[model samples]
Target: MTDRLTIRRPDDWHLHLRDGEMLKAVLPETTRHFARAIIMPNLVPPVVTAADAADYRDRIMWAKPKNSDFKPLMTLYLTEDTEVRDVRAAAEIGLIHALKLYPAGATTNSQSGVRDFKKVTRVLETMAQIGLPLCVHGEVTNPEVDIFDREAAFIERVLDPIRREIPELRVVMEHITTKDGVDYVAGGGDTIAGTITVHHLVINRNHILAGGIRPHYYCLPVAKREEHRIALRAAATSGDPTFFLGTDSAPHTDAAKLQPCGCAGCFTAPNGLSILAQVFEEDGALDRLEGFVSEYGPRFYRLPLNDGTVTLEKGPPVEYPAQIETGDGPVTVFDPGMPLYWRVVD
Candidate 1:
């Protein structure tokens, strides 16, 4: 065992493994990497109800590595018609782990997301009563709001009201990429938390245009400036339980990504945990890494700390895969073909 670093197993707070072959191809990356993950429900039709969430959980369980203890914490994507009774029943049965709030048209397959927050206020209030966390996509859909300012603006306009209305509700701002996000979560002080993506940690919008239009670098709540990236690093490595790891690992095929107009998302799971370790190491925050990766997330979600640990070592630089064989075709890996010193010990 390496003495350089040691800690409890880490859990991913935000993850997306699309259905069927995509799920199978990508699940191992996550299962092999994190001990458990809160799976996103923004699929084709979206997991809208308790029954749907239960079925999705069954499918996810079926897809898991045989005998693997990987826990897929399921979530329900909130929509306008989402019934408070359904939400309460799911919580009572423990089928849905959290409620995902995606503003309509905010991100991939999010067209089915909530059209109006007020319309769902009853559901939100019910969730608060039932002790369910609200995982928000945290961006506005207004045609006028600058793409980069949406998250902050949403915090002010949307998240704040919801938080105020249900002061006891646990709100997780998913895949946060702006200083506004960090500050907002910080101001909420404790109850409000956020997930920081590895891509956002390492790249900015300039990186999107770096060398070319790097569509794979593109994702919702798009990357901000170097200053924001720096701020994110500070927030992430601050050893604050409010900041946790959420790859938001939305994968798209090479065809979708390399098109004249490409899809927004990054396939980072293959290298997700590796990239996170690298980021912490570079920031001279390795000692604080374990708390951020392992302790904090479980604390926020009130999940038990995992029993076993996964290891990352200082050894020969590892090269990440450029693509993974998928039933449709090869899906490009985010941070493809990159060299890194951090490799998960298998």
Candidate 2:
């Protein structure tokens, strides 16, 4: 049996490296394995302008480990007042890679997100003209829509209309958790793609709510039903260029996560690659793992493939820390529940 595999170093198409202490703690987990990542923009105040993006990028750089060549592709948070000129300038200078769309109140720290899509038509048009992608947290905040149905609702009510209006606009639907999401991106032509998180592919709603509420498994665009999980697994392992890896490795302190109104996210960065390797191997798609993790993301972003390589060696069940300590507190690493037999040996 094949025991070892190597591929181009991976890139995280969607990631959340929160500022300050959290950033310092989690940055290395990703940089150790990934060559680059498209950093999320939904900070407390949010990275709303070119200046805000620049400042946040600087902080990320400072937090990065010494001599690590990991590149942080920054993004700006899209709000109603986001200026077209600022986005154009950010794109032109390579200061930002994309702009994130969070329907206001849709998730954590999204209070400043867009309430009316009409207000951002000029910005969207400018993005389409300039070829900058819009990375979206694909969920609707409408109270009436069931949490499980939000992603499907978003495609029909929000994403489809936006894409139809601006056909040239490139979009990366970040951390998609539903079959509806997979089907939409599969049918969406080259202009659109989707990012599936490692956690979603491994755990379904049962992992979160079956016996009790497991807060760490709890994440925004929260895990859906088992059938949807099967669909996500098929799409991810299919080696389709329209889908790729974006471990929305959001880290929240155990204190912050285990509360009455706990925050939404999974700290998957620490064990992300190992879990991915296990998942791919279990599906008999070992040959396609590299394409999912390292190849398709850069091709869609129009970035060069990474020169270096990382190798995974299969073995007995690998052990990873249940929680990683940070200045803030202990952040729980994602537990895929199933024992992983692959480890990044290199």
Point out where model 2 deviates above 4 Å: none
Question: What tens-digit string does per-residue lDDT give for candidate 2 at 1-346?
Answer: 8899988899998899998888899899999999999998989889999999999989989999999999999999999999998899889999999999999999889999999999999999999998999999999999999999999999999999999999999999999999899999999999999999999999999999988888988999999999999999999999898999999999999999999999999988888998898888899999999999999999989989999999999899999998888999999999998888889988
Q: Model 1 — TM-score against the truth?
A: 0.96
Give the Å shift of residue 44 in candidate 1.
0.9
Score candidate 1 by lDDT.
0.85
Clashes of each: 0, 0
For residues 1-346, what per-residue lDDT tens digits would candidate 1 score against the true structure?
2324556788888999889998888888888868889999999899998888888888888988987899889899999999888888888877778999999999888899887678998988887777799999999999899998998889889999889888989899988998888988887866788899888898888988778787778888888889999999999998877898888888888888888877899888888777777788778788888888888888888778998987777677788778998786788888733467777775
Candidate whose TM-score is highest? 2
- Which segments of candidate 1 are over 4 A away from where they belong? 1-3, 336-338
